[model samples]
Target: MTDIELGALLADASQAAAYFVDIHDRAALVEAANALDFTVAAANLAAADDKDALLEQIAEALQFPATFGGNWDALVDSLGDLSWLPAPGYVLLLDHCTDLRDAAPDDFATLLDILDEAASAHARAGVPFWALLPVTSPDA
Candidate 1:
């Protein structure tokens, strides 16, 4: 389990922003969400290896509708339009972000941009959207 506090996470999460939790175990993070005592929209993007794959996985995980176009513009359009979430915020547990980052750095950056922009949009609407990103292992 993450040492991170659920209440604090929720408090920060409530403001509508994207967060990348730095824990390796994505499931533990979900457990933390459970302790949050409220609904949390979650998406597991473990198989997304590239930009298009990532986009499609994200769309499916976040419950994007059938009409969702798998493109940058469509991504931004649909991200802020998640009426099905029904929670204070949304969390994307990306276990393979590091691998994707290594193989497709530019794509990873674009993904970050999209997530940040979406989070900002949700913030404007008083909801939080977080990206729980895991870090590469430390050498120390």
Candidate 2:
């Protein structure tokens, strides 16, 4: 399905599913982040009192059609020491990964690896995790 359609589906999905939408572009990302009340406070990543809250806040702020550079370590680190969702399933959308493919291919791959690890960890604990990655033609 198209990103728009996928987004619509996620919006209508039950809370049992963890949903995330990754986008490209800093301004658009900021706009999306704002829309969802997510504060782009990467500066305080290590000190984030609640990563889930941050994710929820950022999810609420996210908008599509934006591009982002992949920060593999940062993204992976963000997932560290986090609690799992209190549901049977979780969904995540890693947007703009394709954009980072050229400039930061290694980081991009590392980010995917981290995402996979997160999914595996959730699954091992009996929770389901899903992730979505968006790519533009120019991205490839």
Candidate 3:
């Protein structure tokens, strides 16, 4: 989707959800989220072929608190309660995840599940939380 389209979709807290985006549209995605006053954060998973690396990259990207425990529960907790990086909304860009998705499909699926859970939580609280995953192919 175009940035304008993305911005429009992101404006609705109740409709917030995870989405697959064109990898080439990274800049536009960030700009769109920023335009909507969303706290945009990105996790580059290019080098993250395993769950440990995935968690590390996400923690670093989102600037999780020092208390972060570096685990799935910690990720869910942090993503659900992003009080440290407060904003009107949130947009997480998970970039270049194809490798991880291929090398560790289970972990990738779990990550998506956690993200969806967080999105649902935010939606219930009347806040927008979008997770944008950039993939090389439409089928990805």
Candidate 4:
């Protein structure tokens, strides 16, 4: 969705299975979220240089349980079984994700796929999950 369409999307979180936001600046998105009524349980991965960094950042930010095994399978299990985030919607902003995407494209793609799957599962339970990221361009 375009930037113009993003704010409304915050209120209407059922847009798609998940969102892979491709924007150069995150300030705009965060500003919009702050100005609006969207209560997001967000995490920023600007410092995540690899898979472990990514997992740890999310686990810390979202307060995942101790059972979170910090692996791909464990990540999926944790995401699909979120009971802590009781917000109207859950937003995960992977700020500066382009770095990780470039360094480990395979892992990044797997992360996106897992995030999308988690979004689908959460949507079924009436909770919106957003996996926001940055791309060079809109279609990237």
Candidate 5:
């Protein structure tokens, strides 16, 4: 479950949950996710009798916002849809965001808040937002 894969999955799920958008359509979300310079990492999401193999997926998907159409609020709104699900178990993997805090603290903070809201909404709706954000060491 590389960051890129995480982002794509997030986008796909968000699109479906909120806008009823089809993840299979050819669009910028998919294109930009594929175009980004991503890291290759192996990660997996497990389900009984259905193991999801995310090996070799790019880690750049975390930056999907950089390739989308809208402002931060709009982005938040789109993602916020996850909160409405009956039991949405969405996870976001931020692979290498060591610099995100320093490089763009305000933006990152806003992102955190928005995500927090979504998580809260999900919780209230009896849904769970499972997330992971692994960062490389500063020395790395």
Candidate 6:
């Protein structure tokens, strides 16, 4: 999607949710989020083959507090409450997730569920929280 289109889609809190996009669109996605004053965070999951590594990458990317519990619950909690990263909205880019998705499908599915819940929570509070997964192809 073009930066303008991305910006428009991200501007609406109610419509915010997890989405898969072309890997090449990463830059445009970040630019769009930044243009809308949203906090943009990118987590490189290239080496996150396990749940622990995945959580670690995400915590680091979003700057989770030291108190973060490093678990699925903690992830949902942190994502739902982004007071530390306060902004008009949030955009998280999950980069290079193909390997993880293929290696541990269950973990990836759980992550998506948590992300969806977080997005729903944010939407209810009128804050956009988008999780964008960049894949090499449409089927990825």
TM-score of each: 0.78, 0.42, 0.93, 0.78, 0.45, 0.96
lDDT of 5 by residue, 1-140 (tens): 45566455543433322111222322433343334422222122221111111111112232333343445555555555632222325545433343554555665566566656765665565544433344333232
lDDT of each: 0.68, 0.40, 0.88, 0.74, 0.40, 0.92
Off by over 4 Å in 4: 1-7, 22-28, 31-39
Q: For residues 24-120, what per-residue lDDT tens digits would candidate 6 score against the true structure?
A: 8888888889999999999999999999999999999999999999999999899988899999999999999989999999999999999999999
Which digits, one per residue and each the tens of the lDDT, describe model 1 over residues 4-111? 765466546445454555565556656666665434444455666787888887877777888988998998898778886677666666655666777788988887
**Residues 1-140 of candidate 3: C-alpha lDDT, one tens digit per residue:** 77778788887887887878877777887888889888998899989999999999999988999999989999999999999998989998888888898899999999999999999999898889999898877667
Which residue ranges in model 1 land beyond 4 Å of their true spot? Answer: 1-4, 13-16, 24-28, 37-46, 136-140
User: Which structure among the candidates has the greatest TM-score?
Assistant: 6
Over 60-130, each residue of candidate 2 has an lDDT whose tens digit, in order, gives 32321122122344445444323322333444444434434455555445545676776566556654444
Model 5 poorest ten-residue lDDT run = 47-56
CA-RMSD of model 2: 11.0
Query: Worst 10-residue stretch by lDDT in candidate 3?
Result: 17-26
Q: Enumerate residue pairs that collide in model 4.
A: none
Total clashing residue pairs per candidate? 5, 16, 0, 0, 4, 0
Question: Which of candidates 5 and 6 reaches a greater TM-score?
Answer: 6
- Model 3, CA-based lDDT: 0.88
Root-mean-square deviation (CA) per prediction: 3.2, 11.0, 1.4, 2.9, 15.3, 1.0
C-alpha-based local distance difference test score of model 1: 0.68
Report lDDT (Cα) of residue 7, candidate 6. 90
User: What ordering of candidates by TM-score runs from best to worst?
Assistant: 6, 3, 4, 1, 5, 2
Worst 10 residues of 4 by lDDT: 34-43
